[model samples]
Target: MGDLANAKNGLNIFLNPLYYGKINDNLKKQIVKVETTKDSAYFERIENEITDELNKRLSGVLEDYAEIKGHVSSFQSLHGTISLNKASSLDMVHGKWATHDDYIADWLSGLKDSIESGRPSMMQKIFKIQRIREYVLLFLERDFYRHYKVRTKDKPQENLWSIWFGSETLFWGLLISPRLIEDNWENKPGRIRKVEFGYWTIGHVLKTGLVDPENNTIYKFRDLNDFLIFYESILKRVSNSIYEKQIFAFYVDYIRKSQNPLLEPLLIPEFRYEGIKQKHKYRLDFTILNCHTGERIGFELSPQSTHMAISGIKSKTQTELNKDLALKWGREMQKRNEYFQQYGITIMTFTDDNLIDMKNCFKAMEYYLSKRKADRQSVDELIQDIISIK
Candidate 1:
């Protein structure tokens, strides 16, 4: 079953229209330009361009796209029905259709008569009406469902593109993170703790929830309308953070200006590295791919408090201190180095200092690239020397 699933995913990758063209360089440049300018218009323009490209490439598969879209539409319609059912209840007396007390009494009397006669009751009729209303609202008001209904409209195509790309496209991967920190209200000190929400595929937006730490409860959005409201709020807050935004900008700038095709860079934020023997994954800050060699190079931006142990910050417990130390220079570091070396990749470490001075970040990358080239030369010389000796 696992193999079958993998096979299906692999087939889907080939079927993806974006895979037919090389988009890495163009996308890198566009992202860099938009990020630098902080202009919303450029973001929309890029999204439209991507949408047009996808539509053009997938023209041959329109029938398939439509078929899949039909399935999605049906599912969303049913979901909207369920959501309405959960959110609304039948109050026959005070219902929208019959608000007057006398009218409601008559309706109930008629409903009771119908129930006795084995006919569909007024209660059933009211429920169907409410269900239809909810479906209409969901279809019209919810962005995701509306996208499918009106793809050619002047709305932003990012979400539509995400659906088509199976949520694994570079655009989505770079902009979002799996883990986020929220204040733990249960703790008296109101410590800000990290929560791993796992991989947030495009579909996740439909049903994402937040935890109420104080009550040990999970609060879910009532519907798509509710979800979008919360999602936009959180997006503005998290995406505006200085560290992530700066890292993203620097990464894009580096890739755009760097001429070395051998060291093709990809910005993978919150990358997950699976452990060899342990059933766990370690999340790194960023990862870049060397396109020519298919080698992965990792970069980690360590904050001063966690890595440098700068004074005057709230003192950490022993376990927290130990974990931080391991991440910085102890067993965790050793394992990461060993793992990367085994695969002939390099992991570069950085601090807040490098982030502040982006020139230092570029220099570090250049140094690594040059070192790799030099190492190749040394290996070639050694091979020639061995051949001469023989």
Candidate 2:
């Protein structure tokens, strides 16, 4: 984690995407395009200046979170990995006569054998477990396995958490899940979940935020900060219950606020953005027009993107529900039609279904809208006749 501090700014992306929607490629390009206008010298100077300041800020924040001073970080990529020490003998389980290492490897192998046997009974048991979390090769003794954990910078909690052995690992350009995200924050929740394309075993640490001065050398998924990093692709224990609920709540709030005509036409989203604040006057990833108030506000489309602003993660950063947000701006209203295409926005997300895009939403409440329009039309006609007489 070269810049674990780079995380402090956007670590909650797995939680709230409004935070990450800005730093995306499209937005970065837009920011570069907007700021670089005819002044390469000024732009480069600013970049250098920002980089210097960022180093300071990131270092400070990461330290505050739990990173020990003078500890060298082995995790480098944006999907940062912290290489830690692994000792087999010390990981013994009392009475069980099994070391943590042995137990883990055994578990992995048993799981593999179970899957490989093609037994229906095992599959049924696995179906239940799969619902809970994806099987990322249970380690039976020493045989190590690998998985691709996708997420922004905060935490590679979970997105496309799968083991890659063959050709899939070759191209490894961060394969985004070919699924509707955003309104679904199952794996990608709260930032800093690393996507490991290796035989990486995550270190489990206490949440007391205290770092062991002696074990500072272990850095791959190491626990320096109170923020826990897991190399396992899926966040099995807590994802469905906590992550999904929290992000979905945020999306629900967004929809609720959008529905309130206090603004005008609802600001429909074209895409999501991560870190737009640093670049624009208003940082937004989604665009929506309010039909009544006629205020087309820029929305930051995040299933639950929060406010850290760093960028550069391979897998976790690929399946952008926000599309970098640069694509949503400046389009004409007619574009909203896009072939009637059930025009709507995802107001909510979860582990399974993307809930309540505007199109479906409007259909559900169609009667109310129709009646409101009718009432307005009658009033307009009455006024027009009165004016005509005058």
Superposition TM-score, candidate 2 onto the true structure: 0.15
Question: Candidate 2's residue-wise lDDT over 1-390, tens digit each?
Answer: 433333333321121111111234653454346333524454454344434434444443333323433543321311021111112212222112112232343333333344456533322221122111111111111111111122101221132121111111111111112122443212233323332111111112111111112232212322322222221122222233333233334433443454432222212122212111112222123333222221223322233233223244354454562454333422322233331222232222121223225444333223222122111222223222222221
RMSD (Cα, Å) of model 2: 31.2
Q: Write the per-residue lDDT of candidate 1 for residues 1-390, one digit (tens) a residue.
A: 332233334321111111224345676476468545635576566556555554453332333323333532343444454344333323322222211122222332333344456553223322222222222222222222112112111211122111110011111211111222363212112111111111132223333343333343445657544644443443323443466556555544454465642233334454544311123345455554432233456666666655556342367777776776565577547647764754444677777767777567756654443333111222223222222220
Using lDDT, give the best candidate's number: 1
Q: Estimate candidate 2's alpha-carbon lDDT, on a 0 to 1 scale.
A: 0.26
Clash pairs of candidate 1? none
- The CA lDDT at 136 in model 1 is 22
lDDT of each: 0.38, 0.26
Clashes of each: 0, 80
Clash count, predicted structure 1: 0
> By TM-score, who's the top model here?
1
